[model samples]
Target: MRMAAGTEDRERGADLAEAAPIIRANGLSVYYGTKQVLSDVTLDFPSNKVTAIIGPSGCGKSTLLRCFNRMNDLIPNFNMTGQILFDGVDLYGPGVDSTEIRYQVGMVFQRPNPFPKSIFDNVAFGPKINGYEGKLDELVEQSLRRAALWEEVKDRLKSSALALSGGQQQRLCIARALAVHPRVILMDEPCSALDPFATLAIEELMRELSEDYSIIIVTHNMQQAARASDYTAFLMGNEERIGELIEFGETRQITTNPEDERTEAYITGRFG
Candidate 1:
């Protein structure tokens, strides 16, 4: 039998509190050039769970997700203050390697961006570049299988990844990320460009993936967040008009009984 939602949330919270957070943001503020994009946001992401970051457009949801892997460092004028910790290690600390961090924390973009290479090659690329000494074929097959794309593409492993349908290409990209054995997967509007059927497929895949990897997704779709995530974080512009986290809690709570008026407003369609 299923437990009541409140009981489930409390039990889940108790269990999570006993474990260390897989990722944490402490007073994180981000800026480009002179304009601050995010302001003093702090939160923790539990391991092996799906956490959705939701907000209206231009609210720094993507910026916060990118910070986990130091992706913002690539921008010319990007700067941030405060700490992002992964497995308790400061991601931006001295002696930490951003390249290795990215390997552990993979990203899937808004649209399918499969390489021009064949499907087999795309899945094997990361492992090969990392000097994987295991059976390459088995590794590729395992990754594809985990992504739920192996059976569909198994017969045509040598076919060009670009030739696959849009949904298949996105799954192939997921397979590529899994090949690296990443601990966390960050998806930035991963379903924005897909059809309804394809979107459903991805949502299902995410639930399955959370059993093994931490999944943090930035989405503008409230329905998607309510349906797919275990936890939700609502971010919006503060009085200063820079993105700041308004409320965060179990998905049920955030969607149904948000603590902040702003969060309620955004979720209830009163205003973005």
Candidate 2:
């Protein structure tokens, strides 16, 4: 009993709810002063999986990513009202500690930003601040290994972080985040600044990391999302254009066939 080639995508997508979603959002919205960027958006991120947020430029994808770890709070005039629940705990609740939230949910930005210190210091910074009492050398080694940069930088542990290439520096950043022992990792266009080989390496690292950590990435490259992500969420450009969640579902389904016309258009080269 084979389905037709062009059947309804919504029908196929509805069949993918077997797993429970770990992070849930309800009626999420964001505003920058008088400007309303995101509208009401609700979605779920399944545990231990990679969820990619893909859309045209200015989509609420990055903005939504910030909400997970409260990165938005750093922006002046950034205000949002929503429920971002992590393991059933509302991250924005009155008692929720922003510092703890960041420790549990780490972030990696687009560019490779490393401190002007030794490579070891860059990885150990978070743990030292968190009062990690374990063996510092072991922790530094493990975090670097997890980032897949250990094999490349083991001999130069004491070398300046800036001595490494662009790609290595980015991995060091990832290790720094890992040193804090986060449960979820939020990546904002992590590979945009890397070369083709480096991008592939990062994608592979992401897949590997998902075995133990949940990952949410905001990326413009639809192909990367299709290739690396387990779930996909599509967002539209923001207001002035009013960014909003367009559609979300399984990665294969979203790329090969999407529920919304806009998602299909963006994936099929019809539009970004």
Runs with alpha carbons beyond 4 Å of true place in candidate 1:
1-15
Candidate 2 colliding pairs: 238-242, 238-243, 239-242, 239-243
Model 2's lDDT to the true fold? 0.86
lDDT of 2 by residue, 1-272 (tens): 11112332456435544445667777788988888888877777888899999888877788899999988899989988778898889999998999999999999999989999999999999999889999999999999999999999999899999999888998999999999999999999999999988998999999999998999999988889988999888888744687877787779888777867878988888986
TM-score of 2: 0.93
Span of 10 residues, lowest total lDDT, candidate 1: 1-10
lDDT of each: 0.89, 0.86
What are the models' TM-scores? Answer: 0.94, 0.93
- Give the runs in model 2 whose Cα sits over 4 Å from its true position: 1-18, 238-240
In angstroms, how far off is 260's CA in candidate 2? Answer: 1.1
